[model samples]
Target chain A: MTLLQVAAFTSDFPDDMVEDEHDIIQFGGKGVSEAIGAILSGLGYSVGELDYQGERGWEFSAGAEGQQIWLLLSDLGDYLMLQVEDPSFMGLRPKYRQFREHFLSGLTDALNRDGRFHDLLWFAAVGDPFGFPDPAGEGGRRPAPQAWRWS
Target chain B: MASPPLQSRARVVTKSYRPMRGIEVVGPLARPEYESPSDIAAKARSAAAAYVDRHPEHRSKAMMAANIAGAGAGVVRGGYHMAKGLVDAAAFVQRAANPLPDVLLGRKTAGQQTIDLAGAIGDYVIEGRADPSRLGRDAKQAVANAKADLFPSATPVAANTADELARRFSIGMNQGELGANVASLAVGGPLAKAVGKAGEVMALQRFPAARYIAQGYSPEAAAYLAEPYSGMGSHWVPRRTKPPSWFVDSDYNVLKPRGITRGEMYELHARVDPKFSTARLPPRFADRSWRFEKSGLRRHGPLAQVWHGMPGATKAKGGGSLAAFGSGAHQLGEEGYQ
Candidate 1:
């Protein structure tokens, strides 16, 4: 089992703040998710409108080429279940899907622009397994997802 | 000529090349206008001093800030690179279109796992996460993601090791500088090790070179030796020593001593060794003297030599030697030697 954890603060926070904690927008809060979604769209990953199921979480899937990415967003943050045609290559991460999506999409964009033939072929998958669950499905925290920003 | 009076073992030592004739000249061949040690030192020092005098406090602060900013930029760049690598690796797996997904599902080898992980790490470095101490939970988690991206057993042993070490060394380094330094070292270290290992791998394949080079050598060496050198573009030699000096350092005596002043030494050092020149502060006065040892000054090539004169140099350039060096530095850069 592999575990990764991350703590982050929102970027470009407003300079003028005189109110409470809720007004400031903590890192893992709602504003962050919206920002993450926008960044994802900017990177070419289309996120379907999310639907909340009871108290469990929100579910949605983004698709590109032949792959479909299923994600879950809850109070904890976002979760991503990445799937390709290959059954063995399935990947799941908790509460960092926003970063993961952005990272993958940004990478694809960069590679395409870097000289498509060699660059695209060079980076097509996660180089190493980021996190995996144990037989009991109870392992350490999964790695926080990452995002790429060109500007 | 009377063979240049070479009578002292203490001064001149035997060497393969002919003695440097230009060293004995009173004035620099590059700068015919300036003619003495005092002249060169004064010119360089005054130029440097002017700038120093103007910004009594901001100079050092600016330098430190620039260095830190540079380091931070490196880290950001590295992080971005790693993120891009992850995408590539994921794409590679998808394109393989392999039917053995079930067969290889969780049994991936260390090599299989690390290739993409390396890329992800590259992104981390590029994105300005270079400083280990400054890494937030998000950065740590990003590093941990390598385990899932690469290893089937989900082991992040290698990635974690690399991340931890990089972080430790870069604790206080600027994010960019830290990232760049770590990235260079990381990339270079692996390349060096691989190159070392390749020589051995080629030798084991029973290649032709194995006959002599691999004699009594280990398996690794033999393998690398066996491979033909044709495909290997260029041999990369590890940097084992300081880079060669790109400037010439020569000293001259002051026929007439002048009043010691600030920035005079810096100007001289800048003239002669601009490539590696810097002014050193003295116990009595931070800026004084012609030699780097005395003034604690250094200059990059060409500039260092240019800054090697005295009184005339200081007086001609105006009151501030610091600004003189900074202002004409670009020109010195143009005529710099290797």
Candidate 2:
């Protein structure tokens, strides 16, 4: 099978109202989208389309062909839809089990590649998890894109 | 019978005499024959097999067989690199698990120093030059946070004293609470507003931790400090809180005092820019100028020479060539009336 370079990118974070931990809101949440993007890119997919929709966003195809991969870079701490990309690629709903499993495996697999795909960064504003908060009260995190190769 | 005996004796004596004059003995001196090609090949195989037999459980036998087999297989040799890679992988894994204690110690000390310095400065800012107690909870927390940033696993505690606080005054201080004060800063305000400010402080604090990490500190150390400041609304308590960005920003004025502009902080990491131009002046003074002269001009000689001409008027052409200038001339008779 042909391996195609693909990626999924978004800047959405969970709305302040969304309290459910299981919700896979595309761009909503913490570093999930960004993490997914990083994981996919690491797996040899070029994350191409990432558009923002205020509190929500979407990404096009992610991950490479002939490889178990789907990278979704959201604000939810670097999620990797790996070993299977059906839900992530199609932007499906509620990944209760698949999300958690894929996240761990994809993260490990990316880390185990030729380069450290796990080296992808997550930035939170100071009050945020790993970054600083918006000083202007825009309710958005600053995007500091640091690139990494897959391991 | 008597005549036959005499003739026999005479014949025996004649035969004995002939042998004594001409007899020569030969020794075995002929060269040995050479062996066949099959014999040499069989010897090599035997040697190899014997070596393997001696080490029955070792994989070296297989490796040897593989190496020998490879000779005619047309693959380029990579045994050395492969072996080195194996060694490196083993070493990397080992190192990842067991970090050097000495390195960790140094990192911790540096982090502590940073906290101490930041606290002292913060103290001076809050309580005037004399009131030693001015480095308040926020300042105390800043030191702790800075220390946390430096040493990820442990919290930095302050040793409050006149001398320790004095040193930080020298380093300079920017007024305001540290990233650690975020929990206290977040009030009963709407969740949307609280989260934003919280994230900002976290980002600002990440810089120094990032700096430390870049300087060989572990991410674990940075994370330890970041943990206290990362609490969300429900997670945080009131005692650790400080004023919001609006009140704090206006009250302390972070820009005027700290000298910690984003640009400056970024430059501190990149270690470049026009501000660093001051460092370039020293090397510019080359050997042409005397050390004393350079020192006299405060080592601004090169710049001075380049920008403005030399201190005094220069000598004119051939005004005093070494041949005729200030030297006791060596006299010689002209070649006898050339």
Candidate 3:
């Protein structure tokens, strides 16, 4: 069996948006929250929040559809970043592409509709869950692409 | 018969005697001696096990003692950091929950102190004068946010004092209206926005590319190069909102008021234009793909797990280095570039 792979990337939130809890059309706009919600709904994944256990700050997460899609809202309050969960990549390549599309493209479509988040620079990289080593290694992260393109 | 009686008298003889010497005793669980059997090591282990069986309480007591001793030593060695983390946590909650007590006590929270220190340093770095917003955080308005958050009953006490002195000092205006203060901060929000325009205007002029970033321009788009701000400043908030590109995603500098971030330092150094130089750069800057985070910057990728986790001297070193990089980035952009 091959290593289970997951799509992972970092997104930046400008300073005004980083710590915002309230204010619409302003920093921490309602649009940002709605965009995330929309992405979950469109992808057919349930809404979730990270427990953080003994740690500080809020880190929300949701991985549903039998692990077809998953996401973790960054815990660090200073910067807003996102992590998609590890889905088993032992399946066919088309299945892998479908999982990747659900979030990145789903998010892009949502942002286009709301027109709030812009240039949401998503990048490419894959990792194995359960710490399985990858065969390709450093050669996998090539410099040719800066951001991920979606349909 | 006569000869036999003489012989019996001569038969009595005396014998000298000495007591056996005591063997020197050794300490418990130390060297031991056993019978002629060869497996003394195994026998000794069994004997030790038997002793514990007889004194089960001693085993537990010994374990408790060892654990306590280890914890005490840990506290002694790393206690200062532990103590600070605890204090910061308390202040963090208290300041968030109800800052009045902290302010009345004349104590500034860690974040505020960090902001002030950054401003003090900026005096030497940011065009000779630190931005006032960065230098002095107004204490009163900040304190007012907690009224409904922690103790909603204190709503009557929260108010807005329009006087400049209270706004500047964030002191003594502890007696204000919550609704009014929130309102004033909003409609009069222009007041907060108005103070730093000149310095910010200078910053914007120094780099118009900021406008593109502000508008969420795609670097992939042909027009990504920064343009002069023909657009009005009314809605476009700059510099304060987003950071420039050179910043590592995980290494937040208190001086710059940005967050922490990534990279294999050697990997990042390879990407930078050799002619465009800066000091104290992490060998690599975190590309967008690096994502997972714990206490520090983490990629959690198959390979991108380089985060500077230790916080004391190492984090301080990061803060100082990042501060220098802030200046270096400004220099590279402003004084002409290749």
Candidate 4:
């Protein structure tokens, strides 16, 4: 089994943009559903609209193809969690790779447009989950991620 | 050329790359002439200061009025969040326990139940923090927008309408800047109220991002730091319990900086005597960064959604409020502390 290669970035996207309070983004209320919907729409995925339906709980879901990628505000309001199935087989790879670049660049650009989120840090994490038991091993410790931001 | 900023103790950090092409014709693009958020936020305060500078009497009046308005809005919003939280909690529990009547009944969706649960606690949690304690941006916007709202309409025609007889003699009731606000109050009051009320929702629902981009962030960060505007909504997380097959252990040189520094503010460099790599995955799939690759999560062993209309409906409802507020708080900064 190979190690999990994780890259994560941090910015100052506002919490008001989350509409966890209401089923719909309320008037004068901060919620990012609409903003997220706009991004998915830009990516050629016809983002779903909200109604009194089974899919309501999902803040945003872009399953345009059979790809299993979902963006949701977790029960914890901390990080906007992206739950992704392996895109290689979920959709065509080269194309999936394209989806990633346009999506990330567009997203970070759009969010950064608000101007509050800065010092955009990306963490390229490399850590092994499996290692023989040993006392002085770094494996027992949480992966101390190294991050650098794009200016 | 500068390399994209790289930081890794593990050796052989593969260089970053993009596909020769993309699925969509539109490649990565930047907004033309984009102004950063901080820049947009500064505009309002500067404009307000200029306006106040020009009119000292109005400055005193505006400042005094602003303090009252700011404190009032804070207290009101604070209370609203608290009361709303409690109400949401009750609704969450009520619907979560019995969801059968959701279709035209007392029922709420399972997710709704969870939301209300968190909202209730969140409301109380955020109450003490709601007021915009000296939030400069919003306050400046208020003044600028207020002037913008009242000025254009306060023309000679408006003066005529307000003081028609006085206007007939070419002398009108112009009571300085205060008069415009008063005129808007007495004349535009009922009709404007109706129109403003009708348009409030439509106006608010539109242009949030544009407005934020054009102007700035909410004071939620100032009073309580209730936000982290990170544009990470589309990031990939490892969903599979296992890594993909291609992940391979590899090696490369690790760069280390010698801690000892001379007074010239320069640090000596050192390299890891031997290089090491945690593992290597194909570069094309690097963006998949974090993964418990599904290769997908399906229990083909067989499972069924027995009752309550949806399978995880009950859990969604049960977990509604504050079981966990925001997901990625384990992150290094307040970025995850929604």
Which DockQ values do the candidates obtain, in the order shown? 0.00, 0.01, 0.02, 0.02
lDDT score, residue B14, model 2?
21
Predicted structure with the largest lDDT when compared to the true one: 1
List the RMSD of every prediction in angstroms.
Answer: 36.5, 42.3, 34.4, 30.2
Tens digits of per-residue lDDT, candidate 3, B1-338, equal 11122112112110001101121222331232222222322232233233334545544332222222222222222223334446756866767677676567766644565566577566545743445463334334444454422232443422322121112111111111222234335664343233223323443343332222223323211022222112111111112224554432223311111121112221122122110011111112222212112112212222111121222233466687754654555454333322
Candidate 1: lDDT over CA atoms?
A: 0.32
lDDT of each: 0.32, 0.29, 0.31, 0.30
Q: What would the per-residue lDDT of candidate 4 be over residues B132-241, giving only the tens digit for each residue?
A: 55355556766654443233333343232212211211111011213323434567434433433333323223212212211222221111111222111110112122
lDDT of 2 by residue, B1-338 (tens): 11122222223222111112222222211111122322332333333333334445533332333222222110111222223446755754665455564255443333343455578667667666566565465577666645533231343322432222221211111111121123224542244234334433443443323222222223333222223221111101111124465533241222121334322222221121110111000111221101111111111122221111111111122246533431222121111111
A44-124: candidate 2 lDDT, tens digit per residue? 665645433211123334434322223322232222211122332433333424443444446446545524233332322
Fnat by candidate, in order: 0.00, 0.00, 0.00, 0.00
TM-score (chain B) for model 4? Answer: 0.18
How far off is residue B162 in model 4, in Å? 78
Q: Model 1 Cα displacement at B72 (Å)?
A: 5.8
User: Chain A only: TM-score of every candidate?
Assistant: 0.36, 0.28, 0.47, 0.45
Error of 4 at B106 (Å): 87
Best DockQ among the predictions, by candidate number: 3
- Please, what's the RMSD in Å of model 1? 36.5
* Candidate 1 second chain TM: 0.19
